[model samples]
Target: MLDDFDRVLAQARRGSPEAFQSLHGDLVRPVAAYLRNKGVTEIEDVTSDVFLAVFTGLGGFTGGQAAFRSWVFTIAHHRIADHWRREARAPALVELTLDDDGGTTPAAEHHALDALGTARVHELLDTLTPDQREVLLLRIVADLTLEQTAEVLGKPAGAVKSLQHRGLAALRKIVEPEGVSP
Candidate 1:
């Protein structure tokens, strides 16, 4: 599967619908979930916009899978920012649910504890500043490295690191109120 990297990218860049769908399969869930974390109301819509921008710009894109992933996420970040600018307010916290994009909850096999844990993560993330929240989500949620996260945020690596450190500390404070000293 990995060996077809060049073929997939070349075809997708050339406007091959099937290749685009193939790329979407790898990225859709994670990207939508990231937008949801950003409090994006129309997650699927924004996600589609992200992919559209990517496909349109693919002719100019260079590099392999890692670079492609970073570029797509950078587009996602920009789209979320645009959404906020239109709303004229920072993203607000919503009641985090354990529902999937299909708006369905997990089945009986999944524990209530798991759902609560998912809600707990969103709750904790909600406490951080927007910059910190974005950094944490880019790193932990999007699974981007520090460099990639920095690129997405248009911040220096040091700034990204600082935000991540502060974000983690804040989460620790909430999770372990007294045990860990500041």
Candidate 2:
């Protein structure tokens, strides 16, 4: 994908429908998942909105794939913040997942939680501050590099690093208390 990214991006910039489709196809899932992890309620709608912004702004966007990814997430981050601001409330802590029926099911949700330990994961994540949580999400769930996470957060890389470190330490303490290790 990276090998053809430049060509595709250039074509997309020049108004190529195929190129735009390719870019959207490549990015949509991860972007959606990232937004979901960030607790965006309107995942599909917000994901579309993010890509719309990306495509509209692609003409002036100048960078390789890494930068492009960071740029996309930067937009997503802003959108999530905007959503929360408009609602004027904290995001819901629940991580909603759909079953094969295209709706949430108790059995399927239980299986999923057991398989991924998602309930425990969410509980642990809830212990961190919002900034620490966002840093971890961008770095781990979004599979972004330190620099990319920093770019998304508009912070110095060192600040991101510190957040990640502290966040991990907090989790570690909770998971392995009193110097006891599993």
Candidate 3:
């Protein structure tokens, strides 16, 4: 993916739709998944906004894949914050309930999510404290560095490190059986 990105990112920056599509294929799921974990209900809408920002600002950006990744995620993180702010300002709209024949059923969603292994991941992640989950998601899922995750969470690098270490230990204990050894 990194190797393909050199030429692809260059082409995307130049307004090549194919190149941008390729880049989107690589990034969209992770970005959307991260947003979903952060409780963004309209994941696709926010993901689209993030990509629009990325493409619009792509020409001015100069970086390798890691930098591009961080940049993209930075945009996504800000979008989540914006979503939160909007929600805080908005009044209650409607309540949604799941139905078997409805657009999105719990069983259907669960089955679909299971195919992506997201349900299991969610199950494991649900056991974590919010701070531990955030650190793990930013570092492991988003592929952010300790410094990057720290910046995102407004914590010191040492704090991020400790969170990560403790998060992993908790996950290990939860996932592993009593007879299993590390």
Candidate 4:
């Protein structure tokens, strides 16, 4: 898969369904994870939207794998900003339901555990400034290189580096207040 990425990309640009599938298989999980890390509540929908943009725009795109990754994430970053803007103007709705006998169901318990799994990480992430949080998410969750992260954020590489440094320092302070880790 790695050796012939250019071929795959070329095929995808020409609208080959198999090439598209390969691209989607490779990127979907990372893209979804990045959105989830950034606290985008509609992960699946936003991920699909990002890929839709990628697929439609592939004919005009020019780059290697790293550049393609950056481009895809650039679209994702825009979608996240759009999602937040829309959310700010409208309130989200939640539906409530009761299980039989008013007790929690096993399915509910499974979901609760899943939510709890990331709750601590999210709580810690919530402490950083927005720029710091974004840099860290792009770097860690998306596994993007420094330059790629800068491209995704539309910032200079040096600026991205500074944010990443500061963000990591802040997390260190929170996790290791005594300036030590084991």
The candidate that wins on lDDT is 4
lDDT of 2 by residue, 104-139 (tens): 546876788685876667787899999999999999
What is the C-alpha RMSD, rounded to one decimal, of candidate 3?
4.3
List clash counts for every candidate, in order: 0, 0, 0, 0
Candidate 4 wrongly placed segments (more than 4 Å): 96-98, 101-104, 107-113, 177-182
- Score each candidate by Cα lDDT: 0.85, 0.87, 0.85, 0.89
Candidate with top TM-score is 4
The better candidate by lDDT, 2 or 4, is 4
Write down the lDDT that model 4 would get. 0.89
- Could you tell me which 10 consecutive residues in candidate 2 have the lowest summed lDDT? 97-106
Q: All predictions: root-mean-square deviation over Cα?
A: 6.2, 5.1, 4.3, 2.8
lDDT (tens digit, per residue) of candidate 4 on 9-79? 99998889999999988889889998989888889999999999999999999989999888988999998
Order of candidate numbers by TM-score, starting with the best:
4, 2, 1, 3
TM-score (all chains, Cα) for each model = 0.76, 0.80, 0.74, 0.87
Candidate 2 residue runs with Cα over 4 Å from true position: 89-116, 177-182
The global Cα lDDT (0 to 1) of model 3 is 0.85
Better of 1 and 2 by lDDT: 2
Evaluated at residue 40, the lDDT of candidate 3 is 86
TM-score of 4: 0.87
